[model samples]
Target chain A: AQSVAQPEDQVNVAEGNPLTVKCTYSVSGNPYLFWYVQYPNRGLQFLLKYITGDNLVKGSYGFEAEFNKSQTSFHLKKPSALVSDSALYFCAVTPGTYKYIFGTGTRLKVLA
Target chain B: DAGVTQSPTHLIKTRGQHVTLRCSPISGHKSVSWYQQVLGQGPQFIFQYYEKEERGRGNFPDRFSARQFPNYSSELNVNALLLGDSALYLCASSASRQAFSYEQYFGPGTRLTVT
Candidate 1:
């Protein structure tokens, strides 16, 4: 039963400020993590993924995530947030099972 | 190349009725997956089809079924729909079944509302 947990339901940050969205996972084997962003009335867009090797993975839209194996966490971060960055963020974990378990999702609100 | 596409961007159905959602995978993509996303919740896996065959199924009931055509297009059929079934139906496509780690291109999704 591999699962992902996104503790926050919503995160508010001012524009130009650094932002972080927390994510943690539980899996039996090696975990392949991913981050996706969904805009209003649009499909999900892939941001980044962590399969192996690097613990710090960079993604699109200046997003990056750190995969902590011992802590079972992969947190999404950005150096500076923008108003356009407001969207729904989802963290997912795949254990090479061809199926992904997604977190509940965290709504990011970037104020200008 | 165009990304994944879904037909009928919006659909409304009544209780106990049946609805079919269609999805066209990206060009050259061989794997298609279906998901149900309720308002304010993350997408839930429904089914996965590859090479015109069923590769995986979620915990959904038998009332929900799906199939993939030779062209890599797929359809999800739900019978006796309930209000709880009202959600956005999402379709995602990948190059291969083994390429699970790769990013999946998602369609705009079909908003299904069960009254």
Candidate 2:
């Protein structure tokens, strides 16, 4: 069985400041992790994925995530936050299976 | 190319009524999946189809069913609708079922309201 946990229900950040959204997962085999963002009334947009490369994976819109095997964590990070970045972020893990287990999602609010 | 597309942006139905939602995968994509997201919750997997065959199904009741067309388009049919069945039906597509690690593109979900 695979599961994801995002402990925080919401995250508040200031524009132009660094931001971080926490995520962790539990799976049997090696996990394939991904990050997605969903705006109001829109579909989820892919941010980044960790397959089998570096621990730090870079993605679109100046987003990145660090995959830690020992910690079973894949936390999303950004150097500078923009008001446009405000949205609901989800972390997902697929253990080489057809189904994807997603986190509860974290609402990011960037104050300008 | 346009991303995954779903029809009927919104719908309303009464109890015991049946509803059908449609989805068109991205061009050249052979895999399509459906998910249901209730208010204040993350999306839950419903069904996955590849090559016009059922690949995986979630813990849904028999009232929920789906099929894929030869063109890789898919439809999700729900019978005996209940108030609990009201949710956002999302469609996602990937290149292949084997590529489970690949990111899936999602369509603007159809919001279903059961009255």
Candidate 3:
């Protein structure tokens, strides 16, 4: 079965500092990876995805993720973090199927 | 353009009762999927419909059911709801089911609380 793992339960970073949310996956064949952010009482908003080419994929809200094939990882990163960027982050993987396997999620707290 | 829309932003029900949740996919979107998001957990896939047909279903029980209309709108029905059913229900839509890398647009979600 395909699965996604987000090792960190929460990550704390200072404002204006670089941040990384780690994600790893186990899936057969090629993997379609995605990152989504969720605010309190709000549905998830798409951040970025790795479909085909381009190991580094840029997305909305100044977020980007790098797809590392050898490491089997797709880590979300931002050059500088903002207090408003604090939220729940989820990593999902799809095997070109209708269902998406999601990780437990990691809470990112950007300290100001 | 409007994003995916779900009706009744919040709902409260008791165990053994039935609840119906509605969702309308984005304009021209042909696929709709439902997910259950428990507090502090990532969303779990419930069902997926395309062209008014069931495309996929998750590991949920038979009490959980859903359908897609000709206009691509959808409704999720849970019979004999249990307290465990309390969670946020999310609806997502995509251009088509055939697109392997299709991105899904999500609605604000309906918060369901079962007592």
Candidate 4:
């Protein structure tokens, strides 16, 4: 079985400061990782994904994630945070299949 | 192109009642999947259908069932709904061969409330 974990229930950061949302995974085979963001009363928006190659995957809205195989982690990051960037972040993983196991989300609050 | 679209954006039902949620996938897509997102929780995979065939199912019980039409549109049906079933039901669609990935495009979701 494959699973994902977002250790922090919530994260707070100041505007213009860098932000990081942590994620880890457990899979029997090579993993495909993804990050999604959800705002108030909306569905998820894909941020980035780590399928293979290029440990640093850049995605929509000035966000990026590093795929660390050894650490079994794929952490979403932004160089600078914006108030609009505040949303719920989710980490999902699939083990060479269509079954996606998602983390229990981490709410991000970017204080203006 | 339009993203995945779900109908009855908001629905209210009571326990013991059955409900149906619908989804229309993006054009040119052949796969659709259903997920349940409870408040303060990540989306949970429920079902996946391709080419109008059921492909995969999650840990959900038999009361939860779904099907995909020829056009790749899908419907999820829940029998004997419980309060625990109250959540945002999301539908996602992906191309048959997205190549090296199963990237899914999500719908705005149908918010189902069981009172």
Candidate 5:
């Protein structure tokens, strides 16, 4: 029932350019949205999350996300793209429970 | 200062065999959770244990079971593994008592390949 969707399977951006990885969530009650990055053969690393506060939330590695309640979106954004930033990104939502539902994932490639 | 840790970075098993994956949570974390991440897909929740108590479970089958110890370390046991059971098993830890909604820290994960 509660889930997050990443419509884009892959996103490409040139190095030093801004990048955006879109995520929209469907859930009842308030949505706890989170973004995660996974490198090849490694576990997922937390990027950021939006709970109940300000719509614009900043996170590690110069990453930030905007939580739009009206559009049911929580898009991950970066002012500049680096080649190292290229990885699998996932959007997740939890209904104030220990269980989390994740999206299929989006692969971002930063071209030089 | 260490992050979460999982044992046996890689494993190869046969269908119908059983496997046990282990995880050690970060220091002071009271909650441990398990997830299954198939290639090209997001991690799916498998189980969550808090203070050695089962807090939540995912849509996995009964063949999947897990438990946490007093030290906050945990293990996930899967029986009668099928080809579909092959996945990257991830373990995450959090301090549920500290916040309204806690962000989880993940381990490197154990890659299981079943033939």
Candidate 6:
């Protein structure tokens, strides 16, 4: 079965510091990984997706993800964090099943 | 262009009751997908329809069903609802004709609460 794992339930980082939300996926075929952010009471907003391109994929709101095939990881990273960047983040993988399997989610807290 | 849209921002129901949720895809989008997002969890795939035909379905029970209209609008119907069914229902749309696999645009989602 294809699945994704978000190791951290919550991540705490001071504003202006780098932030990382870790994710690892398991898939039989090529992994179609993506990142999404969700604010309270709001729907998910797509951040970035790693289809078949450069390992480092840049996305909205100054976000980027590194797709590591060896580690089976697609970690979301930001050079500098902001208070507004604090939200729930999810990692998903779309495999051959034509369905998406999402991670449990990581709550990113950017302290100001 | 307008993004995907869903109706009934919030709803409250009880066990054994039936509920219907609606979604309108973006103009020119022929594919629509439904997801269930419980609190503190990720969204789970429910169904996907293209050109008003079912393309894929998740592991959800028969109590959860959906259909797409000729206009590309879709409806999700859940019967004999349980507290477990309480969650935010999200609708996503994509242009399937161009690429079979592409990122989907999501809507604000409908929050459902069961008592």
Cα misplacement distance, residue B5 of candidate 5 (Å):
0.7
| TM-scores, each model vs. reference | 0.98, 0.98, 0.97, 0.97, 0.97, 0.96
- Give, for candidate 5 chain A, the lowest lDDT window spanning 10 residues: A91-100
Better of 1 and 3 by lDDT: 1
lDDT of 5 at B74: 99
Order of models, best lDDT first: 1, 2, 3, 5, 6, 4
Q: Of the candidates numbered 1 and 4, which has the greater DockQ value?
A: 1
Second chain TM-score per prediction?
0.97, 0.98, 0.98, 0.95, 0.96, 0.96
Tens-digit per-residue lDDT, A1-112, candidate 1? 6789999999999999999999999999899999999999999999999999989999998999999999999999999999999999999998887787899999999999
Off by over 4 Å in 3: none
Candidate 5: tens digits of C-alpha lDDT, residues B2-109 = 999999899999999999999999999999999999988899999999888998889999999999999999999999999999899999999884222788899999
DockQ of all predictions against the true structure, Cα-based = 0.80, 0.76, 0.72, 0.61, 0.69, 0.59
Better of 1 and 5 by DockQ: 1
Q: What is the TM-score of chain B in candidate 1?
A: 0.97
Which 10 consecutive residues of model 6 chain A have the lowest summed lDDT?
Answer: A93-102
lDDT of 3 by residue, A43-107 (tens): 78889889999999999989999999999999999999999999999999998889988899999
Q: What CAPRI class is candidate 2?
A: medium
How well is each residue in A1-112 modelled by candidate 6, as lDDT tens digits?
6789999999999999999999999998888888999998888888999889799999999999999999999999999999999999999998755588889999999998
lDDT of each model, Cα atoms only? 0.94, 0.94, 0.94, 0.91, 0.93, 0.91
- How are the candidates ranked when ordered by DockQ, highest leading? 1, 2, 3, 5, 4, 6
Candidate 2 TM-score over all chains jointly: 0.98
Error of 1 at A65 (Å): 0.4
For model 2, report the TM-score of its A chain: 0.98
**What DockQ does candidate 3 have relative to the true complex?**
0.72
